[model samples]
Every structure is written in C-alpha cells, then in structure tokens.
Target: MSVSLRVLDDGAWVSVNDSRQVSVSELWRLDAPEFCSCTVPDFVVENFQSVGVDGRTITANVYGQCIQCGETGVPGWIPVGRLKNGEYVDLDRENVVLPAHDGHEN
Candidate 1:
C-alpha cells in the first residue's frame, strides 16, 4: 500500500495522508547523535524531508534540534502512520531504517 505525509502546524505536526499523525510540540528521545544531546527530554523538530511510505509503513527522514543545546541538522524519521488489524503491526517498532526515525511521537 501507499501513503502520503506532510508537515503541518508549522512543523509541529506530521499529517499522514492529510491527517495529523504525530506532534513535534511534545518531548521525544531524538535519536540523532550527530546533532542532539537529548539526554534530558529537550528536543524539537526543526524540519523534515523525504517523506513517503514503504509497503504499508510510512517513512520520512527528519531534521531537528536540542531545545537546550540549540543544535540543528539532527537526522531522524517522521512516523506518518502504522498498520494494524490485518496481520497487524506498528511500523515505528520495526527495525528497518526509512532514512531515519522511530515515529517522532513526542
């Protein structure tokens, strides 16, 4: 299956197929070691790119920063959505990298 994704709410929301899926206004464990020191729950998405879906799983590489450290160009993924109910599964829990990210569900 195919899915669509985009930034909403001024880079605060990930709109999956035109629907809001995740919010960046919340706190998250940003896994970008090259640009974050999120050892204290202090990160926010500054930007995103390359959003699309592989199979039924959504994928999008992300760019963010540490709110405390003031870093940028942090690489990650934007979780567009997940599959369930039919051989159900959560895409965010998968071990495959779609550029980067683990659902960015802060």
Candidate 2:
C-alpha cells in the first residue's frame, strides 16, 4: 500500500514526493491544525504559521489543490507562501547538501 502527495496548482498536479512517507494523522493535522492540533511533521513548508503560543504544530491552510493522480488521496503538508519566478523552493535541508541545478544539464 503506497500513497503519494498530490498538490493541485495551475490546474495541474505537482508531485511533492519528499521522502514518500505517509501518515493519516499527520495529514489531518495539516488540513486543520486548530481543530485537530497535532504535532507538526518533521518537514519544512513555506507558509507554516503558529496560531497558538504552545508552539508545536503549524496552523495554516495549504492553499493548493490535490495533485496526486489516480486518487492516491490529498498531498500532505504543502507549505503555502509566495514563491518567486513560479519556481518551487526545496524544503529538504537535511544532511550534507548537493549543488542546485542552474538549468544546465551536465
């Protein structure tokens, strides 16, 4: 049983395969953190906000549509924010980093 995250943007689906780990509780928390109030997942999103002072999980709405194809369910934890140049900023910053591609194929 493999599930994936699908973000709906610009009438198209974007794959957020950041490690491909799925949890039902985590998704529920992200959709409505105030109502659910679950611990924030160990990932970085652009529009993560803290509604409460306790400061655990983020209480922000993911402002995109589901992009995962074939009904794999809603994509989990998409940080909502203003992105520059219509390009996505990578949220994964763990371990030693690799050089970002400058649109030049090697």
Candidate 3:
C-alpha cells in the first residue's frame, strides 16, 4: 500500500494520505537517553522536522524540548503512528513512553 506522508503547517503536523494525523505541541514521554540525561524525558513536541514510514510504523524526525532537563534538539526518529489496512492508526503518544531510535537503524 502507498501512503503519502508530509510535514504540514510549517512543521506543526504530519499529513498522512492527504489528511492531518499526528501533530506537534503534544507532550510525549520519551525513552531517549541520547536526547537528555533523564532516564525518561518529558518531551514537548515543538516541531516535525520530517516524516517517513518504516514497515508499518510511521516515524518522524522531531524537534522538541525535554521539559525535565530543558534539552532541545531532534531526538532522532520517533514513532508517531502506524499504517494498517491502508489507513492511519494513531499511537498513544501522550500516554505511553515512545522509544527514539537512531536515524541509521531499520
């Protein structure tokens, strides 16, 4: 299946299949040690640098701040959602701890 992914509204939202799906300004719990010194950072999503798909998972290069440590930068590729049956399924970003992966990883 083909999915159209885009960073929309000047990096405020992620457009999937021409529709706005994931968005910025949401607080996400991140398991990203590389992003900050905190074991789990309370991340505030500031922008969507880019978006892509890895298998069925939708990932984004996100620019955000760690509310706990005040660290700011792209925390690598963070999973935002998933593609299932040609439709977009939103991840529980606000409630769950999402793992941030290095860009080189599969």
The numbered model that scores best in lDDT is 3
Q: Rank the candidates by lDDT, best first.
A: 3, 1, 2
lDDT of 1 by residue, 25-90 (tens): 444454455445555424555555546555566655666666677776645554545655322233
Which tens-of-lDDT digit does each residue in 5-94 have in candidate 2?
A: 343332233333333121122222133222222232222222221111111211122222212211222223333222234333332324
Output the TM-score of candidate 2: 0.21
lDDT of each: 0.53, 0.25, 0.90
Decreasing TM-score order of the candidates: 3, 1, 2
TM-score, prediction 3: 0.95
| Per-residue lDDT value at 89 in model 3 | 95
What does candidate 3's lDDT look like per residue over 1-106, in tens digits?
7888999999999999999998889999998988899999999999998998888999999998999989999998999999889999999999999999886432
For model 1, what is the C-alpha lDDT against the true structure? 0.53
How far does residue 2 in candidate 1 sit from its true spot (Å)? Answer: 2.5
After TM-score superposition, the amount by which residue 98's alpha carbon in candidate 2 deviates from its true location, in angstroms, is: 23
Candidate number that wins on lDDT, 1 or 2:
1
| TM-score of every candidate relative to the true structure | 0.53, 0.21, 0.95
